[model samples]
Target: MAERRMMLRDPGLQPERTRLAWSRTAFSLTLFGLLCFRGWCRDGNLFYGVSALISGVALTAMLAGWHQRHGKQFLSLSLWSVGALLLLNSLRQVLA
Candidate 1:
């Protein structure tokens, strides 16, 4: 008798694509945070400064845990947070 390796038949490419999305989301959030930080450092108040800092931290944590989460929840949360950051960043600019 010979031992054989077992693998999922499809091993679908969806996982890879989903991971890429997470990576992209993380990158976008981090980039936004850095840009906002720089911008706010000049005329930005404490509110913006703290918000930007927190966003950066969140982005880092998201990237570090990206591969350590379940598919549905991970994707949903990452995307929602990304959208939130974008909204907040834009709102800061508009209100200023």
Candidate 2:
């Protein structure tokens, strides 16, 4: 079977902070994606708009998952997702 990647345990620990951080990252990605897409798509259909939409979906997915779970795996998933977005941003900057 595929390895399980997310968790949803209370763990009796503070989840609010973790959840808030994830929410912040998600919001940032949504904002960045929009900004980049707008800049890249100034002309009729410059493009990158599709990527902005995808990032929005990713942000929603991360928020939904994090809000419902607070475990190591959940944290890991959020971290990886945020990291991926950062990496993509770096790539865009370098490639541009």
Cα lDDT of model 1 overall? 0.66
State the lDDT of candidate 1 residue by residue for 23-85, as single tens digits.
787787777777668767886555556657666666766767744654346555654665676
Q: Could you tell me which residue pairs clash in candidate 2?
A: none
Candidate 2 residue spans exceeding 4 A from truth: 1-13, 43-47, 66-96
Q: What lDDT score is found at residue 94 in candidate 1?
A: 100
lDDT of 2 at 72: 40
Every candidate's lDDT: 0.66, 0.61
Give the Cα error of residue 36 in candidate 1, in Å: 1.6
Candidate 1 contains a number of clashing pairs equal to 0
Task: Specify the highest-TM-score model's number.
Answer: 1
List the candidates' TM-scores in order. Answer: 0.57, 0.46
Instruction: List model 2 lDDT by residue over 28-93, tens digit each.
Output: 877867775785578333235545555665666676774455444654565466456556766876
State each model's C-alpha RMSD to the native.
Answer: 7.1, 10.4
